[model samples]
Target: MKILILGIDGYLGWPLALKMGSKGHEVIGIDNLSTRKFSEEVGSDSAFPLPSPSDRVKEAKKILGINIDFYVKDANDMEFLKETIRKHKPDVIVHFAEQRSAPYSMKDYNHAQYTLDNNLGTTLKLIYAVNEIDPSIHILKMGTMGEYGTPSLDIPESPFVEANINNKKDKIIFPRWGGSIYHWSKIFDTDLLLYFNQIFGLTVTDIMQGPVYGTRTTEITEEGLRTRFDFDETWGTVVNRFCVEAVLGLPLTPYGKGGQTRGFISLEDSMEALRTLIENPPKTGEYRLVHQFAEIYSVNKIAEVVKNAAESLGMSTEIKHVDNPRIEAEEHYYNPEIKILPSLGFKPKKNLKDEVKIILEDLIPYKSRLERYKDSIMPKTKWKK
Candidate 1:
């Protein structure tokens, strides 16, 4: 299969590209390196240095004998995106090019607008480009579970509800609300893909993923092939942040009541789920939704797991509850169905403790870097003024 992956420099994008390439797929990657730039602007760069995208590709060919074609172009650029698709005529298009940080999106008006434009605009362009070039091409878009907020009922993969109005019966996509501007953009993406699929017969798969945390994958064992790992307040996920705090002997900062429960997946499992979906794609004119996560854990439980793991390794750690910066339900019902992946042969090897232990062990060598940027690890971006 000829696979074209956008945002190839991202935490997941880089690893996915290599994994697919290793499997003998003709892989092409595109990115503007904006994630790295965004981290630099917010004083939250990756904990360790990462090689340039081109350098990494070159090294992969040198060491692993896998050839990956890379282009440093923005996916939102309609002209470039269309031309690339027309040129490659890809069998699969994996879209991951967007501003993905909830806190960063809420930083200010400019950041919010940028997030909206970059995320939605890119999807809009992809829809049109695929429609014009080849509607049969499979599009796998990355979405967030945060789009559902904290619904009262267990979240379905593709939710639908029946309604009756004026003695008329109809079924509609389940009503959803986002927790932040970034999540709202993903919601828009979901709707746009559905619209395109219904009208133009576009084949699409939207993976609503949870918080992903891990430092390594099978295909990314070498230094040059490593993916970016952020551990700051703005860009880091909770698991990553907790691991870094433990390494620095700093208290884990659990926001508000520390009862915000959310789903999580290890990096290895995320890649495997993606691979499973790619091998067995949805039929044309179909918009499929797969919930991607391995386990569910509350913020307090996550903190406790990290603390216990660190203590077992002869390290002291603490937990501290701070005011929640985002306007969200700190304690709410969160049971999202995620049986689709496992049914498709997606077996996750690591549990919560194993995942946390892996991250803690990986960060032990980066303690100096964590200490230097310790002050920037506290939550500062508020959703409301």
Candidate 2:
């Protein structure tokens, strides 16, 4: 299969490219390196040093013998994107090019607008480009479970729910209540994908994935092949932030009452799930909604797991409660379904403790590097300022 992965320089995108390339798929990658620039603007970076994208590509060929054609261009550029698609004619297009940080999106007006434009704009361009070039190409968009925003009801994997509003029995696209500008943009993308699928008969797969954590996948055999692991307040996921805090011997701070529960997946499992989906493309004009996550855990539980993992390595950190910066429920019902992946032979490779232990060991060697940005590890971006 020919696979074109946008944002291939990013954390998930880089590894996904390696995974596909290793499986003998012809892989094409594109990115503007905005994530690297965003990290610099936030006074932090990948805890481990990352080679340049070109260097990383060369390393993949050198170490893994996988060839990936990469382009350093923005996916929002419709002409360039359409030309590339027409040129490669890839079977599947994995879209990960977007501003993916909730806290960063909530920072300010410029940040919010940038998040909307970059995320939604890129998706709209991709939709039109695919429609113009090849409607049969499967677009696997990276969506977020954060779009649901802690509703009281159990979340289903199906994009639509059977609603009987005022005795009008009909199925409607599931309600989305995004928590931040970033999440709202993803919600917009979901709608765009569905609309395009309906109007232009485009094949789409919207992966409503949870927070992904873990530094090592099977494809990461050397330093240059490593994906980015951010641990700052703005860009870092909660698990990554906790692991970094534990490595630096700083307190593991959980927001508010520390009862915010959400789903999480390891990088390995995430890649596997994606690969499975790509191999099994949906029928023409079908929009497949998949809930991609391994386990459900509260923020407090994640902190505890990280703390225990660190303690096992003779590094100790206390769990501290802080005021929640985001306007979200600290405690809420969160039972999201996961029927698609398992039926497709997907199972979790590692549990939270094991994964955190691996992350701790990986970060122990980079303690000094983590220490340099320890000041930026705490919550500073507020939803209500």
Candidate 3:
């Protein structure tokens, strides 16, 4: 299978390219290096040192013997994107090119506008490019579980919910209540993909993924082949931030009673789930929404697991509950049904503690690097502000 991965230099994108290439798929990538720039703007860097994009690609072929064709171009360039699609004619195009940080999106008006523009503009262009070039190409877009806010009722496994309107039964897409501007952008993307699928007969897969953790994968044989691991307040996952804080001997802070629960997945499992989805493409005009996550954990549970792992490594840290900066539920019922991945041979391999331990050990050698950006570890971006 031929695969085209947008934002291929990103944390998830880089490794997925390697995995696909190793599996003997013809892989091509496009990235604008916006994530690197975003990290710099936030006064933070990857917890570990990352090689330049060209250097990383070179290392991929050198170390793993897997050659990945890469381009440093913006996905918003419709003509260039369409040209690439026409040239490669990939079977699947994995879309990860978007502003992914919730806190960053809430920083200010300009940040919000960028998130809305860059995210939506890129998606719209991709939809058009695929429609004009080849409607049969499967578009695997990366969405978030945060699109479906914490509601009182049980979240359905399918993207649609069965509703009876005045005793008339019908199925419709689940209601989306986004928590931040970034999540709202994703919700809009969901609707756009579904609409395009219906109108243009485009094949699409919208993956509502959870927060991904873990520092490394099995395919990362050398340091240069490593994917980026961020541990700042703005860009980091809770589990990743907690592990870094423990390594730094700082308090593992969980906001507002520390009861916010969401789904979490190891980086390795996330790549596997993506590959499985790519292999199983939906029919034309079909818009499939997949809930991809390995385990469900609360904010407090993540802090606890990281603390335990840190203590085992002789690094002591306390869990501190801080005032929540974001307007979200402190405690809520979260039981998201995940049936698609498992039925397709996806298994949950890494537990929280084990993966947390691996992350702590990985950060041990980069203690100085993490300490340099330790000031940016606490919450500063407020939803209200």
Clashes of each: 0, 0, 0
Q: What is residue 159's positional error in candidate 1, in angstroms?
A: 4.1
Candidate 3 versus the native: TM-score? Answer: 0.99
RMSD of each: 1.2, 0.9, 0.9
Per-residue CA lDDT of candidate 1, range 135-206, in tens? 999999999889899999888877466779778998888778998899999999999998888899999999
> What is candidate 3's lDDT per residue for 1-385, written digit by digit as tens?
9999999999999999998898889999999999999999999999878898789878998998988889999988998899999999999999999989999999999999999999999999999999888889999999999999998888877778989999999998888899999999999999999888889989999999999999877798778989999989899989989888999999999999898999999999999999999988877778888999988999998888888888998998999988899999999999888888988888978878788888888899999989999998999999986
lDDT, candidate 3, equals 0.92
Query: How much is the lDDT of residue 128 in candidate 3?
Result: 92
Candidate 2, run of 10 with poorest lDDT? 344-353
After superposition, the stretches of candidate 1 with alpha carbons farther than 4 Å from their true spots are 166-168
What Cα-based lDDT does every candidate model obtain? 0.90, 0.92, 0.92
